[model samples]
Target: MTCSATTRVALWATLLACLLNSGCTGTRYIPSQGQLASPTPPPQALKGFDGNARVELNLPGGYASPDDRAYPTQRANEDIQNWFADSGDDLTVAVRNENIKDSGWLSMLPYILTLGILPTWLTTEGETVMEVKSGDEVLFQNREPVAYRSALSMLLPSAYLLGSPGTGQYQVMADDQLNRHKQALQQYIQSQQKDYETAVSAGTVQAYRQYLQDNPESFFRMETLRRLSELAPATHALPFHRDNVALDNAYIVYLPDEYDIWFLGPQDMKVYDVLRLSREEDETLLASRIRAANQPYKVFNGDEIALLKEGGLSPGLIAAMIDASANPTSVKPAAVAPTVTSATSGAASPGTPSPAEVTAQPGMADIAAQCAKRYAAMKACDQVPSFGANVCRSQVKKKYSHIACELIQ
Candidate 1:
């Protein structure tokens, strides 16, 4: 029975539509380069049930089948470019090499999975499959989903091994993997050691000192001590003991070769000459010593004091000085008298008041004024008058001394 021409045309059109619809409904093979067409039935509209209705969790669409895995092959390349753009020159070069070797794909997959673009899959007996919802939509089934796993695995791991082929580069690609593992272990050890040293260096002074003391055999400790001596010469005398014996009013003098001399008790009449020499001839060294001595007292002024404070001086030293000053006895006259002790000069006369005494006398305005005049005259002389003589010759000095004597001077 042959159909009429008009009926035959209508029947052929209906059959064509059915065929097209069926093709869209089922999966179709497409080459990697082929463009994908929109799926039939599109996606189903999600439904909500009443509070009491048994709720079944629906796995996201792409996660169901391995074939449906949406590996972001294109986006991965974009990310690599972005990474290189933001990185330093060295890192950029490293990334380029890694990409060339296909290692970039391996490293990127983990990241894509985190972004929800790649679905997780399990492999059993060398076959990889994706989890999918069953027909009833109530249960999940592990089915072999379509994906490019073999290609990705081969490309990524191969690339990774290429750029950093193990500890010693070998011709065999398999050996390169082993070398990388060894190199990684060594790098981790070095990093840990560096962290340990950094932590030790950042600790408190006492802690650092203890470390040095305990590690005296270490070369590093010796180097540290040498540096400390060069920077803070006076630190050698620290941790002073009572038996260390105070120098009375002695001043410290620096010698030619980084050596120091302690001139004991400048206040004593016998050492008065040495004190004078230290003050006038060794002014620089004397100043340094005075500064060091006064450091313990906190109120002493000098460049070292400024530096020590700036470098975080111990609070203990400042507090101790304060405590000492609180006691009246702590403040005493310097041991050495101010006298001219040059080799060309004779000894000072007996009972002569010292220059410092003249300055310290109470109500000594007239004495100070007279002394200032004498100072001018003496300064004009070939040799300046002895400090004791200047004080004794001035009437202003007598008046002030008398006043001081009366008031517990």
Candidate 2:
């Protein structure tokens, strides 16, 4: 019940330490005079950092995966996300390798505790710098100090110190940090949109590919895809033979001008014209599949066509058929029946006999003379007005003499 002065002092110290929650109170941030190095990501690389009317984080140059737990940006990002959790904000930070820093306390802790030297022990602090981009513009960037004060804090638990500030000043500090990054993210997004417009007006497929691929999760992904689709291959049906059967059923037949002949079989469509073997028949045979391994196709113009037939026909009738097709009315007229005018006149034969030694056969000269006299009488005087002779008189003289003679002699 009655404690000494030194013992009482020790009791107070114990209560104070307990009030600090089994650990030293939080460390505070002082606005130091030094500047943090700003990130210099290319415009395209920063595409998704500001979109959806909200701020996004992109650290492609930071930790590649959670496997890189010691990465400085990753560590800082975890702190910021935890801080934002209470604010109902979702914060996701992409990681890259360069974000693994050599300056973080926990990273150095391994070397310090492992080496156990005075200088290593003295190195109890780390600095973190992040750019808060709105679009393509930066709002605030500060390289802040972080202090570790736990037994295991030397090699671990750096995140607890990253987003934390001095005791009794959490709301103010967290708000300050959030606002800075939010502004920067918004500015970055606006710049990105403007750049996208300029690029799209005169854009190429390569540029669109870069933007779309790099920022696949960007808010403008659909828009980017629209532009990309313009450059992508169209996905429609090509010139395919649709709803058709038997590609080999049709043939383009041709005839060249050369020989006259009836084109024989393989009749399909009858062509009406003079059938002349195509002068190109030899060439055609040479190029045909029957002659060569492959058939190199050839076209026959209208001029080369003499006939078109659908049925097999001989070469002999081809020329005749062509002529008939060309001129439909070249047939001779039919004969007419003759009328008998005199009973003594028999039907005349459609034949002629020789005039000289002609009217008499060798053994029938007398009968021939009698017939010639009758024939000469039947002839009109107009047949030989100057000599009082006619074609029949000449015939009668030849019948009497075996040689042709003047009618008067």
Instruction: Report, for all candidates in order, the number of backbone clashes.
Output: 14, 37
CA lDDT, candidate 2, residue 138: 38
lDDT of 2 at 48: 21
Give the distance in Å from residue 279's predicted Cα in candidate 2 to where it truly belongs: 42
Sequence-dependent TM-score of model 1: 0.15
Give per-residue lDDT, candidate 2, residue 269.
15
Consecutive 10-residue window with the lowest summed lDDT within model 2? 332-341
lDDT score, candidate 2: 0.30
Candidate 2 per-residue C-alpha lDDT over 334-377 given as tens digits, one digit per residue, 9 for 90 to 100: 10000110111121223332222111222222222223333323
Q: Taking the tens digit of each residue's C-alpha lDDT, what string does model 1 give over 1-409?
A: 3568879889988875443222111111211233322222200110010011111111122111332322222222332233221222111101001111111234345524443222222211111122111122211112211211211112133322122222111112112221232233334434644643664575544444454445432313322332233333354333221111121000111011111111112222112232344545545544344433321121223543443343333334333332332323422322221221111011123444443442343223222222222222233221212121121222222322332222221
Q: Candidate 2: misplaced stretches above 4 Å? A: 1-168, 184-195, 203-222, 230-409
Candidate 1 residue 352 C-alpha distance from true site, Å: 46
Identify the runs in model 1 with alpha carbons over 4 angstroms from their true place: 1-99, 102-297, 300-409
